[model samples]
Target: MKPAVRTGNHYITGDVACAEGAIAAGCRFFGAYPITPATEVAEHMAERLPDVGGTFIQMEDEIAAMASILGAAWTGVKTMTATSGPGFSLMMENLGLGVCTETPCVIVNVQRTGPSTGLPTQTGQGDMMQARWGSHGDYELIAIAPSSPQDCFYHTILAFNLSEKYRVPVLVMADEIVGHMSEKVVIPDAREITLVSRPRPKGRKDRFRLYQPGPDGVAPMPAIGEGYNVHVTGLTHDERGYPVMTPEAQEEMMTRLKGKIRNNLDDIIRTEEYRMEDADIVIVSYGISVRTGLTAVDEARRLGYKVGLFRLITVWPFPEERIHAIAARVKGLITVEINLGQVHYEVERCAHGQAATYLVGDAGGKIIHPDKVVSLIQEVFQP
Candidate 1:
């Protein structure tokens, strides 16, 4: 069997790095259908998983791929899958199922430009909003954006840890640029890596309540064959995991589903600030756009504009409070993304008139240029 953690510096693509990250995080099952940009992730897993006594299956479709992982996750092992735009859409129903059942797993969406097969080989940050809201229901899940190959490696591990800890599916939102880009990634020793497993149910097996939350608003989980009477479904269920068709049951289920994430905002939300100690304008971005924002911030500084960059590492949960705080102090906020205005609207909504909000974005198919971002910075604030 191969080592779970390869434990060395190796030059690799972000897609391959992500596969390694999942393996290092003790992910034993990977079920996916190959798609452009994200194919390498599954390919790597297929070649490596069996060496570690893990399972890798190429499912018939994205829907089945997502369902396969959710089923595997319930078996008390870490599981994951990878896909791009259209496949992501195909998986939405099961994604909602994962949220409803509180299944712990990871889904990597290496995005390409799309409404429908727009650009299979290029990069786009167009799926940011979809990652948060594509699933139809009142639910909340963690979604993180990785900016580079190194980020992809570490962030995939982070995704697994957060998924297990929170008992909800976590997303690694990568664009084609980051997924295909090659760079140096350091995989830490197995002993040095921290892994989290879902909290197991304790006490009398006969009286177990599958959906009863602990003090932290998260329920302890048990595998199907652990001899616990576990009942799981997508319907509105009570603490016992039995379907309860009532307003109260729905409210109770929804509250717990959303509360776990909302109540722990401080832990779930993460952002990186660059040169914002004193600045009049702040550029807000995530994924590949952060790379553009970084360069633009430096150029804006050289041009004598007090500009900074606010990079969203955890894109969901939205980082509203931090962005609001920045908006209160800055004269304006510029959002750089590959979509016309998905996350840009969130930034604008958070600004709340405290500062003017602008968007430097494209329809897709390419990364936003640093020059465009710098120009927007200049337009938002004069010398």
Candidate 2:
């Protein structure tokens, strides 16, 4: 593995690199429950937090873990928590709270297989849809998928910045493969990294409204004991942050929550297009599946196929527009994933009859192989 080069140093493994990135990004609060694949993230944070004057707490359960991080964030601290699928499920209620309250925090879901306890120690991108709608309400979430250890470090910092900027819970949707994979990650110097601080409340403390919009849709957050008696709730509220049951207030609040993400879609959406220009086939994949899909593209091209790869770095807010554009040009779209075709549907929807969409997936505790993906591409092009 090559050394990870960032600001000035290198590191190994995505989990450790993520911890170092968070520390460097000024993340001082971590609350989590230990689970396989993601447990290392919590462990690393536990060992490193004290040295950097940060706080790391192991909560009773994933629910508590989720809640604790939000509470800590309310204290004006940039906070985060890590969990696997089951633990992520446990955190959904609080996750909804973070959404409605518009709290800024990062939740790292290092995914493993399962409807329940499917594959504890294995990797899967099964949680892609859950990251968007798991909270059981209408909300928009920022989800980032990292394909390599180095990206894990950088995207983790980006995740924190987006969470603070949008005042929404940003999900760093990592998987067992990327989380455990050891690779070179460049650690940039602390001073060089651009860190975003939460917008603070200004103007008269007596007249301050917690939900009042700033220049951007995000409201300035004043922490507890900041001399501003700001009230926050899940219920639809006015600028004063008091609950308002009126339809107008409800509509206004919900639109802002959803629109804030949509309005800034360009800044939040990110993807990598490989050999897309003048290509006949495009493989859309993410997380560890993308690594295999990339190799498959190369193998297909070697066989004289005009194959390309589209890697989604930011999973949610779904990159629909870009996929739609590419779908029109490609001869066919193949989606290779670790599940029984979740993202495959997205590809089909975006293709909109422009191209054929194919699914190559594995749901039985192993990754879809590159050869299988290559074979699928060949089969699609067959006469």
Candidate 3:
């Protein structure tokens, strides 16, 4: 198979492609427990890391898997973990820990069906909402959804880049279809990849405050043994890292943490628009559903429906402004997903009554077909 976009040699499964992407982006530590539809990612990392002087650990459970990655990140190592629905649920508590402490790492959720052990091998986008609000309290999260095997390679690298840039944990929310599917992925030469390294602490060691905010709202982080005597905690802390119980300190800390991502939304949010300029109806989708929606768009256009596709590459830090702009021009918005209406609410909220929002979804442990999506578009655009 020929490579879709030039990066390196082609032909790989999405999981192997993602593992290779992480290696290319400088990830040195992987902590994970094997889970179906996502196990290939861990297996590949274990095999690849040792050759490059990196470390890979298979933890006892998903909870341990999540926490171990955070510990590795504190040592200033680029770290990651892989899981499915059930395991993702287990990792939520520690995910909050990584966020509050501003730990930079990557968490890959190759989604499978269900609330609890629903379908171990079947694909579903049921965890879309969980990726944003799974952890407790208010915080910003970056989640990227890949539509194809090739994108899994590119987006995985981007996930690590974003994690390091903002000092926040990032999620690569893939699904079973893309994870197991084999396709050609072109990996770029080492020199061609634009890698983002975390900002390091400067100033005299004694004068340094680990939590001091920079102009961009992100604080420079120091590794555990960097001779900086840095202190880090999940609790709200003063610039020096001591626990600050005062309400003012708490407010300031939370504001900075959330503002870093919010203010940099332009760099953080990404999406793809297809045939949207003359589109009377737009099909909004992500992950595996996006592929189906693309086919639906082509078919609708052939039938003279004037339809288009909007594929979300970045799921979190929702593309509200872009969606609004597109919605203002389209007559209707159609959301397609494997799960029942998870992201549809977001489309509705962003569309804000500018156009009719419709959902074409299924919870039957498989993806919604493109033909079905085309049918929904026709029904909505009936004249």
Candidate 4:
């Protein structure tokens, strides 16, 4: 190790913490484009990656940045990139390629207010849905949201580990507040961190099955120069990784691609429940929205209302089972997000009339206040 990893506690912004976390997670390459709110992540990585013998490349644009990371992942080394809003939109084509190829990589979106530079430096959670469905085609991805700089540090590491373990593009959706806010963060020693690497091919090199999935629906990821004839492409392919254009090939390939993440829902999905065991009203929120939702929950509790928080850690896959189970007992669910109602619909669908679902959000620029969230809870639960 040339620069070596830095292990200790320090006060830092979320973007910086994330860059440090990537280094701790053994990330040796960062490919990204500079954009507001997200540039700090790349800036820190540019400085730190070299200290640890990693490479940082500033691509011409978001499209090339996304492409660069995928190319790096093929070498069996942990890789990552950061972007937000417009840049995120540009990366969709390559993000699909990452998903189809089962490439293990981390994408950090330091979300800023936007609909085309709507508020470059302001915060917004508008991209929640885009993070999930931005890319074309029907496929699944793992996305985690963090509300604090501390969460940013740890979650980025988790994002990389999950990416390697599941062999998919794992996204860390950190909004402007958390990305720019400074907080006390604890960086643990290297040995304390647990990282996952894609399973390696065990068969004879001459007879290797490039895309043959294991019992877990994930195939071993061989390094680029590992003597295996790995044919990687975005096209639908069989077990050998060669492009094949046929309905049968499409069905078989797509099924495994989505199934690998869906089938392991119990392991892939993560959520945080606060006093939900007996609460009549529950607040569903993620990203920066979690902060205000919890504030509302606390005030509701003070007023003697049975209110609890259902904060989402793993935003993608929607945590359907948990939402349904909670909705069954709660009197109402107040879905809180910065976007108008992207995640609210998902919660409502899963609730299925077991409980009423309501939304409290808007377009973005300024964050929704805690009082607004409290008022929504009041409307839903007021007698």
Candidate 5:
């Protein structure tokens, strides 16, 4: 049977919509653990995976969950796992393992207030930086932020496609409020959804050159049972996938790992510009802050201020080139998020002194009111 994709519109939470999106993306394996504000994703997958001939296993812990998904992906199956702050942290070690082995997978982090279980049911964007740097080393990966139930449904598919396209783990950064908030989610028919498959290796096993990248830089992935001489290790390896510990070997291995994604920056970076054609200040934001960011832009316009919105749909890869060009044109750039300036630092670096940069941060319990965001605009733009 085809993946049990829920066709048409329905009232659902972001978590449920994400699970449905995964099914539509042709995910045939899921290794999950129950965590607050994110368990709904696993619960929905458990109910639906088997219906679509997919396997759903509830792991003992986040580490094992992360490991199980990576193992499943090696069998040429699309896989995913869902978790929150604490669990996301626990999976970091294995996350690196996935990256080093170039295992394609999707990891969803339904963020809740944290720094060690700060608040179980509250929302927060504290993990934004962690998502980029958490797993350690210098590997580049893709991560997307969804602001609503609809976006969670949409971007989860994009996350899977990108993971397969790049042969690395991709992240869906959702939050407590968005995850649990019920809203209208329009899931299209399975046939209408465009799914991308991982590139498959071809040629004789000895001549395959397992690590040899294709024209697009991503190497073709081969299944374990295939007759290919496949050997994958976390240590530095050559094109044949054999372990090579010398510094030269490490450089060659690391270069391909980072270069493949970095070389295709044009294809990886994605953003949204709202009413930004002519504006003096652009409010840069992603995730849940987007709700208030748009409100602030609207109110600022009402007050006769030249304000616009620059939303970061693909949170990682940072969209530096776009910001670099915009920074020169705008008088200033304001970054708003539910944490103390995590993405703010990225905006500031991209500004490069051409535009003044400001941060409108939240401590992460309740949503930041639009009034407060507009207050910052008035304070900054006013004489």
Candidate 6:
């Protein structure tokens, strides 16, 4: 069998790096339908998984692809899938099934410009809100945005860890630019990497309740043939994992689903702050935009402007408190993204009029220029 951890430095695209990272993280099952930019991820997984004693399936479409991973996840193996915009939309129902059933898996949406196949070869960040709310209903999700090929390598592993820990699907939101761009990525020794598995039930198998929440608000998952009666469904089920058609059952199920993520905000949210010490204006961005935001912030600083970049590593379950705090102290907050205003609305809502918020964005298809970001910084510069 081929070694799962290919520990060394290699130059590769973000999609391939994501596959390598999943392999390193103990992900042994991948089900996906081929799509532009994101196809490289599935291609690499198809070639490498069998060599590592893992399974890779090219499902009929994104729906079956999403369903395959969730079913595979129940068998106690790490599972994942990859796709772009159109496939992502198709996966929403099953994605919600993954959520309602509390299935642990990673979904990598390597975004292309799109309202509907707007630009398959080009990059866009239009799916920011969709990643959070697309699945429907009231549920919290953990979405991480990777800024580079290296970020893709590291954060995909993080996505798996978080998914297993919380028993929810975690998203690695990458744009076409980051997904297709080649860069040097270092894969460390397997011993150096940390992996998380879902909590397992103990004691008598007959008495086990499948969805019973432990003190940590997460339930221990059992494999189907473990002699434990496993009943999984998308309906409102009690801790026994059987459907209960009542308002109270729905409330209880929803509480457990939402509480696990909402209660652990500090542990799940990650951001990188650049030059914020005494800065009066802040640039906020994630995924591919962070690269441009960093460049723009540096230029503004050289011109003697007090500016900084607040990079969102975890976009969903957004670091609202941190943004709100910064908004109060800064003269203005500028959000730079490829989308017109998905996350910008979140920032504005969090700012609460304490700071003026501006958006540096477009419909899709290209990365926002650093010069445009700098110009916005100049326009909003205070003294």
Q: Model 4, 215: alpha-carbon shift in Å?
A: 1.3
Worst 10 residues of 3 by lDDT: 1-10
lDDT of each: 0.93, 0.88, 0.90, 0.90, 0.91, 0.93
Q: What would the per-residue lDDT of candidate 6 be over residues 271-376, giving only the tens digit for each residue? A: 9999989789999999999989999888998888888999999999999999999999988999999998999999999999999999999789999999998887
**Cα RMSD (Å) between model 3 and the true structure?**
2.8
lDDT of 5: 0.91
Poorly placed runs, candidate 3 (over 4 Å): 1-7
Better lDDT candidate (1, 2): 1
In candidate 5 the C-alpha lDDT for residue 159 amounts to: 95
Q: Residue 226 deviation, candidate 3, in Å?
A: 1.3
| Residue lDDT tens for model 4, 18-133 | 89888888899999899989999999999888877889999999999999999999987899999999999999999999999999999999998888888887999988889999
Candidate 3 yields a Cα-based lDDT of: 0.90
lDDT of 4 at 226: 81
Structural similarity to truth (TM-score) of each candidate: 0.99, 0.96, 0.97, 0.98, 0.98, 0.99
Indicate the TM-score of model 1.
0.99
Over 187-269, each residue of candidate 5 has an lDDT whose tens digit, in order, gives 88788889999999877777887788999888999998888858888887887889998999989988988998888889988
**Model 2 TM-score, all chains together:** 0.96
Residue 241 deviation, candidate 5, in Å?
A: 1.1
Which 10-residue window in model 4 sums to the lowest lDDT? 1-10
lDDT of 1 at 252: 88
Error of 2 at 100 (Å): 0.5
lDDT of 1 by residue, 135-234 (tens): 9977899999999999998899999999998999999999999999999998887888888889898999999999889988999999989899688899
